[model samples]
Target: MSDTLIDPPADGPTERPLPLRPALEAVLMVADQPLDSVALATAVGHPVEDVVAALQTLAEQYDEQDRGFELRHVAGGWRYYTREAYAPAVEKFVLEGQQARLTQAALETLAVVAYQQPVSRARVSAVRGVNVDGVMRTLLTRGLVEEAGQDVGTGAHLYRTTGYFLERIGVSSLDELPELAPYLPDMEDLEDELERVGGFQTRPDEQPGDQPGAATPTEETP
Candidate 1:
């Protein structure tokens, strides 16, 4: 028999499975926030335990090599971050010619709001010892905080950090926020003060005698 080569059938090219480390890297490189092992495993079609081990190994290898960026487990998940030593460089690069960065006062207020969410404007002001109405508006405009709901006891609108805030900080959840000393004012005291102060007082545009849940007068037609 003559040695003849047969042509392959034309349906589609065969797809090869991706290697573990490279596949994980590719998924992580584009991630907008930290990804838990379960998510990474599902994406790579691998076991969760195996993904966890792989991530640990990758982190160790990066550390050994003194890489500028390292794999870090943060916010209950894994993500790559520039080493702390290089933060200044990264900040400079990101802020180059960018003048719209949040001010120091806004950042402090944001921190308080973040740590004490579902909080009222009065509570925030009490904590910071200053009026935060304008700063709160700025945070709202920046999409960092949003109205959670009105306090049942105080009738004051409560605020909480938004998902956009998490994305901006590269955290998966609020639980990942750094721990702080428990020096915040007592919640009970704040509530009591709010109750005594008439709780967020009605907006200035409302009628003097208007009360919450009250019926509004209708216009009369001729």
Candidate 2:
């Protein structure tokens, strides 16, 4: 990041929030997945129209400056990705060894996305009792899951297993999957459980209350 990007203007109000574009950049820097305009608006305390404009300007500025990364809007949210031209370098650095298999957490996260999608990571986290952002990224990179769209009510980005997932799993379609939904707790009981307890399991990040840096879904994740 450029010093200019990180530093606020000397003339600007010291007590005021970071400017829209820079604030968006700050938030995007740490996000593990795309975040919708509504979520960004909520986080930055900006209107949706302003956030959209700021994102577009940032994207244009990066392209004009020939930066090494790009801002992309996928589904209903936006995220930063290394520019495509730099993919080879990233791949070389990141894929340092022979590819390893997914972790137990990733497998469990995948199962949730496979069966319960189009679902949100928050919900997947609720189901598996751990944050699924990292696992969801792994699945996305592995071509096992993809963004389906946002939830209509909450605007949370939803994910579903991809065609590649079915192919790898030797299933012709989702219809071939086991009937697990039927095994879930009754609807009211499940909501009560989720509301009462975060999930079946939890880590340092999970909690019963609204998740930090998470969109406040009208419904609970668990």
Candidate 3:
């Protein structure tokens, strides 16, 4: 064999492309949010018709095969969801895991946020009487809490319990969040605690209980 140095072609392919279905699955697996047809098509470098067909076929195959997870199209987008038939198993697994793992402090912090949503981390910390940054990050990572908005006065990011949190707790709304309030001090004491910590006291009237929307993630990501 002759010794030689080779220069690669600059304009040719860099890597072998994945087939359409595999590519779509790969993208959806990593997606934290639903992807619409146009996005999926652009990603897989396929036509929209082909993408839609592949998605439908995949959905049917999953259904027929009785898979634990499924491909679903909702709110003008497509994503992977736990198969409804398997939700109890998944929920049991998740709730059991959560119960085993979440610490007492985390549970307390979660309760604070649950009862006082759109709440700032500062407020949660003040309520808990300790800095809750790390614990809050854990909650965020576990999908138990999520950024709702920001405090208009201080600009601190506010967070709320996610739909996943509600699902795990077996509640349709915060109104049904039980056992925390009785253990907490009376409203007068709680208001004093808020005032002492320079935090806002979330009003009961603003709890969104009356409107009680399902803590459902079917339409969007938590």
Tell me, by TM-score, which candidate is best. Answer: 2
Pick by TM-score: 1 or 2, better one: 2
lDDT of 2 by residue, 1-222 (tens): 556655668888655566898888888887866888887887788888999999999989999998999999897789898999999988886565216676777777788777777876666755655455556666777777988987675566678999988998899999999888776533234454344444322323222222433332232211
Looking at model 3, residue 133 earns an lDDT score of 58
What value does the lDDT take at residue 21 in candidate 2? 84
Q: Superpose all Cα atoms of candidate 3 onto the true structure and report the RMSD in Å to 1 decimal.
A: 13.0
Alpha-carbon deviation at 194 in model 2, angstroms = 4.5
- Pairing residues by index, what is the TM-score of model 1? 0.43
Local distance difference test, each candidate: 0.72, 0.70, 0.71
Query: So what's the TM-score on candidate 3?
Result: 0.47
> lDDT per residue, candidate 1, 1-222, as tens digits?
979987776877665657889989988876645889998988787788989999999999999999999999999989988999888998786556234788777888888899888887667765665556667766876678998977886566788999999999999998888886266666666655433444234442111111222222211110
Provide C-alpha RMSD values for all models, in order: 19.3, 10.8, 13.0
User: What would the per-residue lDDT of candidate 3 be over residues 12-62, giving only the tens digit for each residue?
Assistant: 767655699999998887665578989889878888999999999999999
Off by over 4 Å in 2: 1-22, 31-67, 71-79, 91-98, 179-182, 186-188, 193-222
Q: With candidate 1 superimposed using the best TM-score fit, by how many Å does residue 91's alpha carbon deviate from the native?
A: 26
TM-scores for every candidate against the unseen true structure: 0.43, 0.58, 0.47
- Candidate 3 lDDT at 125 equals 58
Residue pairs clashing, model 3:
none
- In candidate 2, what residue range of length 10 has the lowest lDDT sum? 200-209
Q: Which one wins by lDDT: 1 or 3?
A: 1
